[model samples]
Target: METQALDFPKIHAVLRTNGTGEVTINGTSHPIQADDEAAVLREALRLITDTAAHLGRPVKVTTTDPDGQGLIVVSPEGHVSEAAPAKTAPRRQKAPAAAPLITSVPEAVPAPAEQPAATVAAPVQTTPTPAHEPDEAKQPVTFASSVDQSQSPPTAAPEQSTRRSLKETSFLVSAPVLEPAAHGWRGILTKLGFRMEPSAEELTEREDIRTVSQHWPGPRTVAVVNRKGGANKTPTVVMLSAILARYSGAATVAWDNNESQGTLGWRTEQGGHNNSVLDLIDSSQTLLSPSTNAAEIARFVHHQTSDKFDVLRSDENEEGDHEVTAEEVDIAHQVLTRYYRLIVMDSGNTARSANWRQMIHHTNQLVVPVTAIEDRAEAARLTLQTLESRGGHDAELARNAVVIVSESTDSKRSMSGDALKRAKAEAQRIADGFAPHVRAVVRIPYDPALVNGPIRYEALQPATQRAWLAAAAAVAKGF
Candidate 1:
């Protein structure tokens, strides 16, 4: 395996003593649980063969267990075998020197009279010139000619001659780099003093983390828009803000930008004060004051302890008739921008509202969230169409929007066999519909954690978390 490079997609597995392990095929990870190491490997092998069957070929896997790490090749037919040992290449033997041709020797010339050795001053030591610098005074020396005692030796070339180009010269070159592995069996081997590189999955995960953790020059806003109820806009806002804050360590807040009663407050934890967007609007003047500190803004926004983000609710009073106007939206936005580096806004169902247009005006990135249901998908399409028809920054946002297609909440519980398959196919169909019209479209599997209550990142399944991370990375690229 060391002597040859395999072009097949690789699998990485690590089994722990607590009957828990992870198996990553290609770049997607799947969790495995069993009673012992044998069961773990059995499950891992099943996963490997399933992936191989899907790809219609074989795959190479590197596994780590309590004993140690090993490599194997598994085929779609369920055959598993140890990888071949490394073989050293054969050394080449040197050919014998050919005998010199027998020919008459030329007559030697008579030597000239040797003159007294001239007193040559010690060579002057000069500082070494850098590679980028042209050494004009230095000339090439030849032993064939006698020393010049009367004048300086000739220079290598005339001043008008072209100097060596920096592009052609190599300077301060380092040895080849070895990317250290920090995941799975390869990482274990590295910890044991062997050098290895990370797998493709680990590299991709690192890149996604890096993308979400980036800091732009100014405060940026993302508006999750879909002018339909139960479109998953609030969950999208919460998850995106959570991922951004958790990875970037930045001040991120998810604001409910609804004109009327919004469910964001119901879905998120409440802070000490039940201050809403209406309260913030009233205090915008004070919050915008230069003398106000950041801690004061915390009173209006609810803090999520585990998710590491803040949630700014809309007017949660059911009896309240006051709706946020465009002016109030600007007021709240200005104050929030002063305190938060990233703001993710959750919008209401009415796209024609003044507050909705105001939120769109402040958005730097647009995300459209939709469930797999037909009505939700149609609503998302109509929402984008409305924005594109405006023909300005709104159109630009619509063109660059990231669409998230989520599986229906009831599909997991009510569907099975062909019904579940049809549900997934429908989700994919919806995702495909948006793929051509938007910058990116991500399909999220149904996760019960996001169905009800405050959505926590730790409660999501591994696949759901990976999907959201990818979605967040896609949104970050817009910034």
Candidate 2:
């Protein structure tokens, strides 16, 4: 076999050892005997060479799992020896990008004094699975196998909450009429007039959906927040609520909290009452009364006929100079919480406002949405940082937050598929950094229908709808 181009100046292997104090390789415990040790050493060397060969250089390997991790060095001749304990580097402050996917050799390993400068270089991260993620979501994209340095016993990987695929759906329902005699179960069922319900391929339950469904806690608040305007906050709230409502068959509402002029109300059904959240608060006495229930609450809110969720419009009256104060929000929160199974907030751009701060405090899960634009991303980063520094009610929000990178670019411009892929890849790259800080990252591709106006999931194209489902599933898992 050709030599792999792994030009690493240093390499260290962190291995799991049995009670007998011998390292296991490929399921054999304590490969201490000549043959077993040789096999273990050979496998380790093969892993390194294959990894280095892919990069066409000497491979670097780093092991910094602090949970009783054992380390060893592989000689060029394929001999395995214990790594110096004191010589090991300090705890890894941050894992490299490729740490999630490709091989990561630590700078902890000491290189021979004669090694050249070109050999000791930057770590090669896999367009790697993830920096903060465990198992890099457990299935790091088939780049290569990575040695798990965790000292804990092996566990099953958790399912991914978001779908990362860019491929469009190809499954289409055929005409209800059976073409000919049935062959398979689908055709036989179709011939029996069962095609209308469970068609040839319904493909209704998606991976993201199944994952999210596993963690369904009823009645929670998800705040769609970003300090930057036009970051698709309202759209994010609408789309996510629609997706959750559709799947969970639960009552969902999008509450717009803009202090001044806001547009979420403009896009949703105005309902029977011209009333907004302010009106709901004003009638809080009756709304929150023991006699009142969800049906009565709908009179004050807008209900979307096409979509199952409701909308609580912001104070849209220009004359009142209506700014929703925390007290008013509290009243509405009390009522809305009682009635709605999920309350998604379309928050304002002002992070400093009392309303915004209160929303963050009450938020069970934070969903920070940002467009692909640089400034918007910066604003999102700032928002997360501010939440972290706030320290009171919001410090943990940044840690448990879901960062949704939305593609607000107009699809009408007709960008190429490759360009779209590049954009998605960039979004994933940003999300990789966020994986360590937030619970998960969700990406919503640009949908022309959602770019502006009222959002109806039915009106969305199949691809757009799929994207929303994936985004919502990501958030549902966190809940």
Candidate 3:
């Protein structure tokens, strides 16, 4: 038997934005740089293959990137394949049958020349081999043409009964069934008894759904930020919250973290009462009390019936002179976090405000939304730069931010032919500019539903909904 002890050291690689990352093997770290994440993975695989060649064994590698985690095995001969998870349960081997002991032996007798005496042969006795025995003894034995058909075969010994120990049997058993396809031609065929697999597009959609429908260890906060008005921050927050809540079935809230008079309430469905974040603060003492029921806190936040998410709007009283202070932000956040598992915040156009900075400190994921207009894009860039300059948790959030570039809504109505083509090109160009700086960049097409009126998940165009789902999945990956 070939030796199973020839194992190579495992490699761990992390791919960051702009194709720069680090790979660790056998406790030693190596720098890896390339043009993008795909290129970085290729470079890391090459390094792993080289290590395998040097050690004359196949190397296993684990990777973490924007695409998520993966495990692969790389061989010196340039062969690569996904590595299956290692088993943890102890293995059971079938015990060999014990040989019968002989009591007495008879002397051999010569056969007569006239007629061959019917030869009586005793059963062949076998000895058990020790662990230290040669490898040849361990080789499996085969009997075929050597056996005489006329002679009766020896009675085989019964296999020693082997039963799994109670501990070896797992009480936690998972379903061993496959999910049938439910979309495209595969669905039709499956219903007709063909059992066809899902198409690539259906598979991709399922993956995106699975990605968004995940819950992390604790409550996660995503900040949709841009320090410039009309950058589509509110729309981004609404769509992210809607997608997350609809798919994950978790308590999600879109909080207007603006300082004053935010438009989130105007663009979303309202509850029975005209309550806002300020109202929530006024009732925080009761909401945070041990006797407070989960549903009791819903009085201050409006619920979007179709989107399956709640909205915590900013104070919209034009006659009142008030701003959300940093301390007020903390109080509101504490109350909301107690009731919601996910918080998608819409920011005001002031990055330097105490409330805005306080929101940043609690953010788990940063999303920058910008229209195709040059000023909006510039403002988004400046916001990320400001965070990066802070040099701590803020900088880390900036480096791992997700930038979403949305096409200008007015362009679709006013532009056409060459003008419309140029508009789309501009949006793509803006999205590309942020690809190197942030963890991911997603481009959203202009949709009429997002231009004005109350925003609802069902009101958006199908393409617009898909784009938002992809964006939400990308944000979920950060958690």
- Give the alpha carbon lDDT tens digit for every residue of 388-444 in model 2: 997866988788888888665653576678867777777777667667888878777
- Model 3 earns a TM-score of 0.65
lDDT measured at residue 456 in model 3 versus the true structure, 0 to 100: 84
lDDT, residue 30, model 2: 20
Query: What is the lDDT, from 0 to 100, of the residue 146 in candidate 3?
Result: 12
Q: How many backbone clashes does candidate 3 have?
A: 0
Ranking by lDDT: 1, 3, 2
lDDT of 1 at 190: 72
Q: What digit string (tens of lDDT, one per residue) describes model 3 on residues 48-70? A: 65666555455666655433355
Off by over 4 Å in 2: 1-207, 211-218, 411-422
How many angstroms is residue 389 displaced in model 3 relative to the true structure, after the best TM-score fit?
0.3
Stretches of model 3 off by over 4 angstroms after superposition: 1-178, 411-417
TM-score of model 1 vs. true structure: 0.64
TM-score per candidate, chains pooled: 0.64, 0.57, 0.65
Q: Lowest-lDDT window of 10 residues in candidate 1?
A: 139-148
Best by TM-score: 3
